[model samples]
Target chain A: MDDLPSLPAKLARLRHAHPGDFNLSRIDPAAQPCSRGGKAADKVRVEELAVELDGLQNRFWADRRHRLLVVLQGSDTSGKDGTVRGVFGRMSPLGVHVVSWKAPLGPERERDFLWRIHAQMPGNGEITVFNRSHYEDVLVPVVEGDLRGKALQRRYRQINDFEQMLTETGTVIVKFMLHISREEQRVRLQERLDDPEKAWKFDPKDLEVREHWDDYQRAYRDAISATGTRWAPWHVVPADSKTHRNLMVATVLKATLQSLDLRFPPLPKGLAGVRVK
Target chain B: MDDLPSLPAKLARLRHAHPGDFNLSRIDPAAQPCSRGGKAADKVRVEELAVELDGLQNRFWADRRHRLLVVLQGSDTSGKDGTVRGVFGRMSPLGVHVVSWKAPLGPERERDFLWRIHAQMPGNGEITVFNRSHYEDVLVPVVEGDLRGKALQRRYRQINDFEQMLTETGTVIVKFMLHISREEQRVRLQERLDDPEKAWKFDPKDLEVREHWDDYQRAYRDAISATGTRWAPWHVVPADSKTHRNLMVATVLKATLQSLDLRFPPLPKGLAGVRVK
Candidate 1:
């Protein structure tokens, strides 16, 4: 944040999707909207953001005044896992947990969708990441035609209100939608199938989902338009390049944590001679 | 680990304290036993080690084959907190936890000493760092003469047995004794008292402990010699210089994890086209 200090306004206005008339087509997934210079300069800038983030998290952990929820939602091969390892690898397990959500299982499917999601939310002085999240309930259901019209609108409203309440209670929410081009997805999917080590990540279900690529993209755009609230605006990260995807998310996270101006808490009573006087 | 690969054997041999004749005096707190070159080169090497460490941790978390316990034991001003920030700052909160142990209280005191220590050991696929550890039980009691002779010897044996059991169950243990000179400690303690921001760290009890410097050193020497074993040897870090202390610990941790040679576990059956053999 200290080094990438100049991009705050540009970052928000460029990548943040606005409500109602948000146009996903205007943004290019391959473009480096937040890149400082060439790839080399951008890579170095990301490292700076990572170091600054580590420093801020130290204070945030000590501050104990705020909780953090980071949602990473994207296509199957759009680099959510990479973002976790590259962007958040430096933070300690003392305060952060990464929750990779899959399809709803027996009991999770039996309850209201947010029940399991709510259970995983970060507590005070902690960070909980959803590698995928309730955002999926909106996406998959809408794409499959199971949820639409009044029901679809209701789901989006539920997410917006839930996020607002969390913010009201001192949790900072940051949502990211990793937008990768259709061509990039094809290449990534092929790579997963071709590389034996990566073959394990290649789900036949992903192939079935990829067949409805355009439908999924349309679903994502609608969800962003409906749910991009003031409390938790969605940062649509360009995800064709893994480094830029990580760089943008790291920059935004640092900026958000920095905005709080976290500080060390006051010393405990009778220690350091700090008394009420 | 790969870049600093040349120094592994020498690293273990030079700093590792032997069981009975673990003479703490011969080791100079200011000496650079593990310095690659000068300060600049050592700083760069530490960064490389950190990056490599990040990569290994990713595999370790996925491997889920072993747990890791790192014990950082030292005097009041020997840079334990700084080491946590500098050496392990790059790790994610998903896999690594830094626990600062204070004097055990209430129920912790009600039970035997190892009770709380055992409760905090790392689970599978996790790493837990003890900013201070159960070793304090050995040091404080013996220094105050509340425990001595055969009683103290029994406590040491109990600790050794507990650690050995943990190793037998698949936890890799690395113990570091951050050895700083008495004069270095005096300066640090004075700085803590003088700097208002750092004043909170100055404990009044620490001053009382510093007065018995020689007795504490004797106690430390005894503890290290007694508890140092095949499963967990004490790495006596020359920690007057903060950079070297972090550098040495990072190198040792990298090497230790490297020896494990973690790999990705086999993918789940019926997924990735892997069926019965």
Candidate 2:
């Protein structure tokens, strides 16, 4: 009855209707590899989406009041950086803004994780992306002895309420938890080490956490299950392949922006040419 | 005699050398018919520069301390916005930041014009571009009657000093005044009026200013000649063709960035893969 479709059912229908579109080659949490059939079609769609996104971004610049925020959360090597470049690459310069959350600033470190994030929220008619977001506070700190017990519980509550408020204030939060198998991450990390161009990406710090990969998985499951909601829902994306990752993300992004029914604002009439003679 | 080449000659050499490296066809600032050049070498060179620019932009992101400032000033339909998108599109989302100055904000209008521009100056390791800049205080207001006599002279002095300060603090200012013949502008204005898609771009107010084109040109020449310095200089780009324009601008941008000699910061050793066991 609502104007919006039930997101869960919509996702389920999409998965069923476009079974070939799903990237099965990506192993799930269990480390068992799955394979899919429509890689070529998926790639073409992504290119199309990139161009459409350019138009949408330009429209956002022209319209000036609608702002979009994309949140990417996932295991290491889930293609967050690449997706950002691929999906939003065609956007015009002034229309989009991307903030990748790393170590917080001095003031940010003192306050809650969400405080710094809130500060970077997009103004009207812009798009802001969080490469790794507030979820890191819950995921990283909880897994690594940075925060524990009641502090963790309080954070989850704060995150839910914070997102709800953001949604109420015209922010559309599309959260993606990039799901990948331990085996895939191992292979990916090895590739980073082997490829000279990618060597800069190889951080030995990733392996220490790789040992406790199961703990991180459990944390992600809990965080996603708890925070997934009507206004700001979480999408569990299988991201073993970069192409699949870009397509899934673009499909969701296009659907979300299109739902807004963006159109060019009417220009003032008689603006053609003024007679100065 | 310095490591830097002769500024004026170096820029002119670069522009002439990269005839095929920029796309100047799309930016027809005149009311004439479109023309095509059949130089395969030029087409190939333009493509090469596009790729090179991608690499340069990545290095810019990795370097982080070298900020880029592209200042675009031009007549109506001079293609400033298009140049920005075409030239800087491939840069990392993190490194490039664009600030388009408009009729002053309430707070901005009260303070000196240079004040608003200064606040938007790029932080260390970022790129800040001004679509139109503080020159407007001296250029537009003088042409429009909003500024005159003692006030105009005072503002001009304030701007030159302000820019010197920005250069002193490590801002690399590359100013471009897009130069199109009056006949070219007439063609562009008519194009906007003729094409429905571009109908929104035609503003009658622009024509009122067109009447005083020579006055504005004289003002531009005086201001640029006065303010051009070793730290920051204005490049007057001929803008009759978009291909020539894009190539010329990209070459200038490349020459400026290459001169910076950016290299990736050394990564901390031992930060790579830690044993998870």
Candidate 3:
């Protein structure tokens, strides 16, 4: 990450590499379907990582000056919610703000796309998370032909400038595109169909998008290549294994926050007289 | 409380009567510095009220529509932070937001007082707790002479209308004024000086305000009486005893949210498929 001058070249090399493509069978998981791993090594590492993240969360809370923004985007069943809950489970509630941007509300729809995004920015010393963000203006509209031809291309330029402005204004944007294979997605889709509680999460339209998988992939690749920059690099996370994906994300966050050099400010002198008990 | 018409008369009567001066030494605390308590019948009733409030928090989370706004205002030893921590400890992080307003930043100081307050308003179904809010425009500035002469009266009018607007837009505002005695304040201030960690919380300037305690009380009484409405009533809680204060604040919150008649909305039928394994 320190090699900021050559970040574009590095990202291009990553974008060009062959991606992971492993799809396993669909299994009907019981009440305890959420698992880390049975292996001792995995358990120990996850525990250590959890503790480290807790410390990081405390530092972020205590410093209360530097801010972080994490942008998560992925295909259906890519585990955006799961990733957040797993990684930030131990974080202090005060230090983190999670905003799940749904279909725009009345006032939001009337404004330019970035209007709502800008409104959700965290104040100093906090973290703001975007479940899916302004990137959708480019990705969804492009692949779905919701904004076709000239309109679709225009969105790309607007999004790039929007992200760049956010970066310049002390917002550290970490965008993650969770990459899962078609077969793996199919399994998840089936699991959703089978579980009554999860039935609400499924959409017939989602299957239609699955049909245009290659088209969406191309759109994603183009979007990443066109917009990723030194200020905000898109990390194309391998999502076939949930554990591995969480680890990679945690590591990136740790490195980035550490680089920022956050520290607790010195307490003001002689405040003992303020306590009530 | 359901009999609002009669309750207003009762509140009027309570306002006219002089409250017995607060004595901190008599009431026993059951947490933190030491845990001891008497099973007072009134305390038991308040504790039950708090438990009911927890249920309301769950309902707010489920409904995602009835947002609760709690405004805590008082002199220094009012237990605003403690009330938030104790009462909302079990509430879902997803549905709650706490804002502690201190001195305004340069940009904030340039704007009208309500500017920063409006920015922190919670979305639908979210509960936002403000520790010292827009009322400070009148309370602090009026006492401090920061806004001299005619300017002071304008702020009170503006704050009243701003709060009315929030109520009109479905935001329930419950304001509280914590009342403590001079002798009790002296004991708490002394305790803070005796403790190492609490020493940093004291300010010599706090004593400047303490000197004009009667002036502040008069300002508070006028502000509350002028602005308090049926839609958003102000509750004056005796807060010399930390346990009694925490319980009273919790009781007020419980009553306010429960009055909203919050209920969970049905899940979108389409997302019913997912089950946690």
Candidate 4:
């Protein structure tokens, strides 16, 4: 962790902006680049940031000028739910909405890929979190070999265009790809099986998907390389340690919200002096 | 507090099934029929129930057998958002989804009221909360005089049929009307104006609606009477005290979930002996 930069600088370093020559393997998932101290200290910092986020979220909700869309993408057991609870849970449910995308059903499959996604976008002054997002369209098909060559490239371009359009509007998009090592995933999957309460989360299909781990990684790298734009850049979060994962996500989110300079809408004229009787 | 019944009994007493001559004014908004103790103790219990709700939610999501839909209807400043935070916040965001309904927009206005609502229903094993729900169509229209006489009656019948069909198809519906007095609403609305942070929540239109409070209350009584069914019951929750409100809602929800006999899907065949490696 010695060479790790400041939080903002580390965010910059981890961001996937322009395409080409991006390697997912080079990044260490266990690295604590955003850690302010050891486990106990980081836990406290995460709690502090969560409180601060709750305050900012209230103001942001009141501002009504900007909309925030946070996208969390990762492999099975990559901590998407954990990240949401740790980072975004402090905000009032009125302000923050979470959409956990699953496989398309009848009506959804009939429409284009982005149709369902467009319907779930945040309204003015709302923050929306997508658990597994549109990126899954690019990742799943590619790894399953159902989409390839020019077709796959076309989808990536489509996603980039869609995100660019959203950003051009009032939406601020923050995407995080929770990076975890295969060994860590193994442990998590095993724990799911070993713990009776978690048994239902252990899907047999997840094992089938794990067999294509390398292919999925390659797909993720290529997808990120192709679509990560300045408008909706992707942040690679090292998530081996659950505490550090929460810490890194909280740090990045705080910085993004701070940069927005959120403020409550000015009181209506003469409203302050008006009394409610 | 001594008069407070057991959670299950309280839930039964609060439920308005087969509603007939149900008087909204008869229910005291300041009643603490669900409170276990004073404000501080009730607050602690609310927190505890929230955590338990979180655990049950995990199993519910994993169970994937039933869909839960919670509809919260109240006049403005009746604490819809507050109840969500105080009661539902502890759950993992992945399992609980909240859809706060606003006035019909362009496309929504083009469609029938239930069209937009049907599109947002929870899938199997998921819990969906509607902050302000399809019931708004009945209240707003009736109060505005746009829908009345036979037309309003027809809509209520339509809603009953819709809800019955949902329940028949494995959805468990719980509806709550957050009952607050006009004086309480006035105080709450005033607090919103005085607190700069809360000013955004205070819409001028709410004041206008308050002028028609009696009409809205009558509309609510009629609507709830027409639509309350054995399959989908409505609960009148005294919501003037925020702590008691949360307690009541949480208690009802916890009882509802418990009644389902929610359990994790039986361990997949021989999965207990299966190794990740």
The candidate that achieves the highest lDDT relative to the unseen native structure: 4
Residue B13, model 4: Cα distance from true site in angstroms: 3.9
TM-score of each: 0.75, 0.81, 0.66, 0.92
Residue-level lDDT of model 3, residues A1-277, one tens digit each, is 3333313342333322222321211211121122355545555665567658767766776676667889888888887866775676445445667787777789988999889888889877778778888887787778767876677667766876787787788777777777777777888888767755455456667777788887877777767766676667777766766766666566567666777776755445655234532
DockQ, structure candidate 3: 0.17
Specify the CAPRI tier of model 3: incorrect
Q: How many clashes in each candidate?
A: 4, 22, 30, 0
Across B1-277, the per-residue lDDT of candidate 3 in tens digits comes to: 2223313232332221122232322322222111125537545655565556656776676566656788888787667756765566445445667788888999999997788999999888788888888877677776776764567666656776787788888788877776777767777677556654444445667777788776787677767766666566676766766666666667557656666666555444554554422
For candidate 3, give the lDDT of residue B175.
76
Report every candidate's CA lDDT: 0.81, 0.69, 0.65, 0.87
In order, the first chain's TM-score in every candidate is 0.93, 0.85, 0.81, 0.95
lDDT of 4 by residue, A1-277 (tens): 1122334675666787765556778889999988877999999999899888888888888898899999999999999989998998777777788888999899999999999999999999899999999999999989888999999989989998898899889899988999999999999999998888788788899999999999999999998888778788788999999999999888878877887878877667767756665
Mind giving the per-residue lDDT tens digits that candidate 1 earns over A1-277? 1232544676665444345766777778997877887899888888787777777777788778999999999998999988887787776545667777888999998999999999888877888888899999999998998999999998888988898899899998888999899889888887765565565566667878988998999999898888887688888898899889989899889878878877876544555532211
Off by over 4 Å in 2: A1-44, A110-114, A144-154, A191-196, A202-212, A270-277, B1-47, B110-112, B123-125, B145-165, B202-204, B270-277
Native-vs-model 2 lDDT?
A: 0.69
Winner on DockQ (3 vs 4):
4
User: For candidate 3, what is the TM-score?
Assistant: 0.66
Which scores better on DockQ, 1 or 2? 2
